[model samples]
Target: MSITWYIHRLRAMGPAEIAHRFVEKGKKLAARGRMEGWSRYRTSGPLPVLPGLADNLASAPDRVKQDIVAAGRDVLSGRYSALGADWPLRDPSKPFPPTIWRLDPVTGGLWPGSEAYCFDISYRHERTLGDIKYVWEYNRLQFLQPLAADAALTGNPDAIEAIEAAIDSWYEVNPPFRGICWNSGIELGLRAISLLIVTSLCGSRLSDATVEKIRTILHAHQVWMARYPSRFSSANNHLVAEVAGEFLISLAMPELPLSGRLQAKGRRILTEEANKQILADGVGAEQSPTYGAFTAEFLLLCCFAARAAGQPLAKGIKERLALFSTFIAWLSDAKGRTPGICDDDEGRVITLSRHEPAYAASVSAAIAGYLGTPAKGPRPPEIELRDALLQAPAGGPAPPTGLRTFAEGGYTAVRETRNGRDLHIVVDHAPLGYLSIAAHGHADALSVIVTVDGKPLFVDPGTYLYHSGGEWRDWFRSTRAHNTLTLAGVDQSTMSGAFNWSHKAVASLDGIEDGENWRLVASHDGYRNRFGCLHRRTVASTLHGFSIHDALTGNPDQTTEIVFQLSPACEVEINGQEIRIRSEKRWLATLSFSHPGQIESAAGGPAGTGGWYSPRFGIKLPAPRIVWKGALPPEGLLTNVHLVPE
Candidate 1:
């Protein structure tokens, strides 16, 4: 866990040897991409991606040639990967030597990377090599190993040479032929890699030695899978990979003892997890359009793998999977880019598409192949998958209801649909899967963002960057970043420590009903232990605007203060009546709250947004305080807040 442990391990590890291995592997891949460009889709231009059609298969060889030729041009033009034979080890200017596993705060520490760092690498940054080893299994190592095995299966000496070189290189950065960080990575990676090997070799009647090696690897992966059931227990990508991998290996190798039972359990997990992960409305909880697509693709891949192996995947899994992918289509703009809500806006790359086709292409293709129909109906053209995959969101004919759950994105969006007006309120009730709420999660447990008249009066600052130093990440995770009530001037929960992914509390939608308007009551335990606190936030549409209240309750006598965070540009009006603060270009807001008779008011001090990296710009009520008249009521503390018209 200590830097010294890593350093000592590094001393025993050979950086030069590791560097040589990785460099050689990179060279082989770069060479392959140059030799067979179709494998990496290097030649596809940045628009109208039409390369993966069945018609193209007739001229597959020629296409591959053209691809390689195009890639060769990039190489000759000096526009490809620049690693060559010397990389991290020989690059003395880099922070850590190639073999020595060290964590960059921008990345993570060596041995046991933070859970936040680990989950991001696995689910978000899976394609990239990083301190988080959990990703290696499901993302990189699993997919890469098959290419190496395919070369060996073909009896292609060139590919075998490349495979050997690649494996050697992989081991240098990843010593002991396993991951360096979490044990979960090793368990997951080995399963994926072995499954890849099994599928790659199963298509060919290979030599005895090759077949035996494949079986051994497959068995080893099963052993790892049995030991790591927790990996599949969650509703994330790792669970998907586990189920699919188990099913694939089991069907491919029927004689294995655990294969049948694992397949059964895997199928169950897949079905249940799919339901849980795909929201009632069909969007990933990460609130990321790209992650939504990525998650759907993983589900579809698993579904297909299960079906192909004769495993009876549940009937609704495919439909549910397609629905989630379709949600991605719904959110994408004309250009195919889903709004960058979370992590990477680019989405995850599955194949060599020219542009990231809004990730709708992958789903479209899967639906086309599975449903035996082409995409059509009411969805966007970019995401309109073949007919079979097109299923409308729940409550089809009826317009969607308010406060619908977006399980995939881990938030609840409650909208007010009255007459022709559209008002929206999104609360982060997302599950703690791979995403680290540490920075993205606001301490405002029952914090809410309201968009009245479709304008953001209150908001969560989204995210800045995970690597821009601790202060930046901390501020992004602080209570000040969100629209919520902070008590006693304490900025939500204390944020001085390192980011903790495990420190999660779900904000569940307990009751939602239709009155003359809409009412929402949601709660979370984020503040329970510290203050025996439970924040119950209620929003109801009123005559003009909406009425907001937060009932914070605990024990004993304590003085609690609540602030309704507004955009610095907002023109503030306090109470049911409008009383303006004096300012124009400067920030203005009315501050008032009835806390019994004890409620007091003060002048504006320096209540501006702090945090050096992330600038919370705008006018702040320097020293604003509203007096509470008397003792708090049993209904808890009620603060009526509303936004003023621009």
Candidate 2:
């Protein structure tokens, strides 16, 4: 066979050396033991069905199988084929296509799409794979294989021939099988593998050459799986597939030379990757709640497959999946929406639910199967409390927490601290997964969103997407979008560049104590990205309402204007006696007053573009960047009252 030629050509490593690599890795895993709840014993072949396997749900028996069949036909027949359009690239042949990789229209810098597409897709898709791992592929294989086998068992020569021809056509054209350095090609190869398995099962005639080709492809896949040094050995969702694919294919073809020890290496790599990548907080390193759920689902599939194949189901594997399943469930709200902190696929990636309720049900099913816990009703606080249990070892400074409002990693959490009487502060800072903050970051770094009662007099204008229009992008990242001091003439960072390096309005709420009226002192570097320095302070008045104090330093002569505009969801009222603002969504009302300190301007600043800034979901807006500007007085303070229900 030509397999030796390919394997030796890539690296002259002998089979012994490759096998040794796996053995060494196994020893390292053994050293870690079960302290981290990782099991060293690995599995091969179809996973052993657990004790309650009969109770396991199979996504409603593929009730939409006909729809899937129709869709499959459409895809195969090139009907409704917007393949290139759906992707930013025109062709898969090109590396880093210009659509996602080009000079920014504004900054003259390299576009962010290249990094965005790779990171976002890999991270998010892997999350989906987490929950559905190989199930989609395997289930589809199971269906197609049996159907093909039946056709062959009967005298349906035409059906068998047609399936064989399709498999051959796919294999002939697939880029990886042909010599191409494409990631999508790897995915396409997976598709081809599924096709071949189905065709072979259907009593199709196969030449000796075809069987050899299958062996070559499987070997190629294994080589691809092990190419990346650290990757093949890690314990993340990616490793699960990378290793699981080879293990499954090898098991299917008993003639392959893969030894039990060799297969154990791949499984070891899977476990190791999972341990390091999944956080004790039950959050994936990638940090999107949607992806978190994705990861859990796929891993469950892996465990199921392992157990069914008679391999040992690693210790704590099910618990980890259950934990993350719960985390995603907890992050979801009544609306079944998470903070879009990252590129959430709306559940379409893994063919899961799109909205919250469906996702809640899916999670419940997974949890019930794995944890035997009830899947419905309000989530227990233990979900949040258990976050502490996921913390990395001692002396590793605790992962960011005590946040009042932080949305990153496709999940947003808003907190209202009542540690002190009538004191309130909100913080927002979460890890950024695959989402772009190029337009949504605010100038109010460490800026606190304050309220007196149930009114939101001062706030950060919740951003909606970048493509809504240019005005939306510009305005959403402008000083006006946040509750902070703005110089009348000076602008925040130019809205021409991606938001990765750009400043975001965030706060540190680790050491806040409730005393008088709620008081939070936070800082943001958004303005500093342009002007050398500028600082603003917002204080909730212990007496009447809330006031924002402006402290300006750089560009002293720079005309400054301080406008306290209410957020879109806020109800605003301005009067001589008091200003009241209220919001039902946030369930808080606030009054805001700002003093134009050492700053003066007659004409309000230029209007910035405004709108939502997500690629996955659709958003609508009325006008472009909205603005309100006025004169500023030296050392001034503006006050607003927030009314919160007593």
Candidate 3:
């Protein structure tokens, strides 16, 4: 971030925030001066392992051991993949997993470190830094868990040797607070979790020298997290992750005198944040379902650590966990995939398996297993493995499964099983996320996602990029990228930056009724300020499919383009006002428009243009998009989606 941009962002903050920034700046300078000295690279010390971590690792089922062994071997063999994209993390010609820690494989940008201040790094600028996320993802060292677990399970010499090399290389290169890894609290938090898990899994086998280095690394991580905490607008998931990291470490290392202080602080902050970040109805306040799951995962991991230590969090968390799990069950499809409502970076506290496209189902199952909530279906194998590691009960209550309304979360759904088809539709009338910045929230209000027989048809394209000054970032979060009506060729909410919202659109639930056909009525004022028009959508579920009516009530003569973003599985055939979608050779659905308008179909853009969908972070695939350009009539622009019976 430039000084000019810093000043501009500061101008947006309030007096209290500005004051806090100055105080933190001074504190950072003092800490920077101390950490920059010769003591930073120190690597000689004795660190005690966390309580219960060793036992839990030992008790992992044989099933988990088998998968982990393979993954560990793959990681050692230099087949590194992250965030649903394969990474060229190592120089294959050199020895295994070389010092490529600072390399951003995406753009091939190498970050430098010679006593650099954390705030001085220009990591957010993609043109220069090459997507800091790619760098940070690898550096999180999440891949090490399986490697160490492999060593623990099979006493694999190669696994232990590879683990030692990775740790030693990390210690040699990225000394505490001297590199980009030490900058963000969330990065520090996630990295701390990975380190703790590895230590638990293979602390006994690690070389004494490597163990000493880890001891030094963990102490530095604790100090950094304790000193600098994310606050105000940035305090959403980042705060929870940081505190949870501190809490888990503290729970493990109770021998240290300061460990209790960190433990109490982490526990308190996490408890408070669980309530603040999650709505009463279980939806994450960020308006992103994935973020909700991320927070839930963070909490669950902490709870696991606490349980291992025979200390549990306060009662407030259980209530929220139940609600969060319920929300997941409702949103999840037949295949266990949930709606990609807003921004999702595919962030996970633990990277046990990368094959699952997203972690909501995994999280849902894990939560159910831990809480003894009745699971809806057979637990996923990965979920079973995680439960075994966390020591959750094997079987419990069958989780509730049905469509209902979440009034507080501003959502309603319709589930139908008729005509030999299973259809589910979710109507989003939710806020533009939480906090002043509304970070991670998309400009997609009154958007509807449709799934038939557990397959996405009308989809909400997942977020592909963040902190990039490219058009793709805007496109992924734009109104045009959703299944909704886009008016005036602009987003529903204005963007200040990648994560910041300059102007927000307020959405409300007009009404919801069910008789012969299930209907949802919602409206948003995103364009009312500029165009003096409100976009109200009526979504009715029919036996065949769905009917969407986009009404510009305040002004009927306004022009708008109705967009229905298709899943990557869809192939389109457009003819007149009726458009057909096929999944390979099987006809899926047909969309018929009532308004006389120009029809255009788009697929495969060079860089985040129309007709693209992101299933995971850092990955976008070509998908067809249906665009209808016409005037909003007084009765509203009607489009019906008729399901094609097999």
Candidate 4:
């Protein structure tokens, strides 16, 4: 870690956090000695299997069971896949790769596993881990779910043997409190969930010796999470995942001595953290729709586990879950595609489907099932299977319809049907981010995303890279990268570090007028302190189309540039002052500006400076970006977009 990082941490974190880390480091040092002979340690007794495990397994839809079994057989046959790649495990009879292993997917650099934590390994800088994402994928043990499924379905002895051998190999290679895999509580939490799923499904087939080893490893994970929970500003989604993992382990495996304590602690933390990280508007505190979906899924899993254990969720928790589901459902476009705003790591708590980059429809369907409501759209097979597993009662109330505004979240959605076509538009004028770090927040203040007939026309460029600490990271998060106005070529929010924002732009909704046409007005003071200017945006949505007026107050001499990023699928042609946007040779909309300005189209080039879109983490594609630059007029500027559906 650099001195700058430490300074930022000190400034962002409080004295209590510093003290907590001090103590946590000591505990880790002491635990290192105890972890040496962890494999030889004997459990006090046989672990207690979860109550109603068999019933819950049996409750899964027959189709889901068959799919799980099929996935497991595929894994055994060395045809498994993860992170958009084919990943095959070696034969069980062969020794596993050494535990002290570090390979950079991006740069293909390998290092001893022991050095994973000892040295300051910048996964981004060294290009050693490519994204450090694959490491987490490998450690999450999600691949094991299929194995457990196969073992339970066919009573396949080879499947059971494979699961046992894999678990043992991981344990032997990765000692507790060591290596990159042990560095994250979120990873540990995911592993715990995977372990529980496997054990709950195939525990009957495992030998006593194998069960003991699994229990021992689980205990270590529980202790680690309990000792070093993601606290303070760090307590975001990672905290939720960690506590949920501990809670699930405690609920599913009553065999450990600390299971009761873990259960209570986990429950308390999960409940409190859910309320803390999830806003009252049902949006995640992180302010990213993708992260919000991921968090909601995690909470849903907790609710599922709680229900199975005969523990009902708190009334407030259930309501919050419903709100979360509603928010995502409403934000999703007609095609069930959500805007890739803020930091999207493409993280999932579980893989129930083969759909790449979990679809909004599938997530909404699963949520609808859990909440006992009719799905708003067509349900995919994965969602159907999950709905069955969730045991949702058929036929219930539907979610509220029409234009809704989450004032606290600073999100407004206007949905209308014209000419038998659905038009949905979302306006964001929320705070820059959640906590001090705002780790996942983007600098796209006053940005808007619009979908006509369920297709994205105007879009958010999306986060392309984090932790790479390069121009690309900065460019992706800069003001110019978003569909917003930039003053003097400055970002709306100051980027202090890779994940930290300083001098944040404070934005608020000025007012909203609803009628046959809806109007939303909002402004941000990000430039007020620096350039003595404030950017005010007005969006009016009519049946025919929409108009966006941007005005800057205070500074008239400064340069102003307005950007409108188009979806990668959109093809645009500029004729005089009118810009026509089309997709697949079909005209979607036309944009016109009131004042003459320099217009330019941008795409990624060899210089690495241009327009680009990242559909998922670590993947970028060329996209069209329209820029309008001119002197900041005393009266500001206006741009009108008319949707001309044909």
Q: Which candidate comes out best when scored by lDDT?
A: 3
Model 2 TM-score, all chains together = 0.50
* Ranking of all predicted structures according to lDDT, beginning with the best and ending with the worst: 3, 4, 1, 2
RMSD of 3: 2.6
lDDT of 2 by residue, 1-646 (tens): 2353333322423465567666754754453332211111122222211222222221213322333333333222312111011222223232122322222222223322322222123211122112221222221222233234334334345444434444453334332312121132224234333434443343235444444444555554554444433232123344454455555554444444553544677467556545544555555554544545555544554465466557755666665665555444444433233333332333211221112323432443444444445542233221110011111111111112233222222222232334222333343333322222222233434334443332333444444333322454445545555545566544443333322322233333332334344454434444565565545454444453344455554545555545444434554444533444455554454444454223211112334423222323223232212223444445644544444554
Per-residue lDDT tens digits for candidate 4, residues 217-239, read 78888877877888887888888
Off by over 4 Å in 1: 2-168, 171-183, 186-237, 248-265, 275-296, 308-311, 319-412, 416-422, 428-444, 451-457, 461-481, 489-511, 524-534, 553-646
lDDT of each: 0.43, 0.38, 0.77, 0.72
Please identify model 2 stretches exceeding 4 Å from their true place.
1-169, 175-181, 184-219, 229-262, 345-349, 352-368, 376-427, 431-508, 512-608, 615-646
Candidate 2, residue 263: the lDDT equals 61
Q: Whole-model lDDT for model 1 versus the true structure?
A: 0.43
Give the per-residue Cα lDDT of candidate 2 at 184: 26
Q: What are the TM-scores, per candidate, against the unseen true structure?
A: 0.53, 0.50, 0.94, 0.91
lDDT of 4 at 176: 68
Clashing pairs in 3: 374-397, 374-398, 374-399
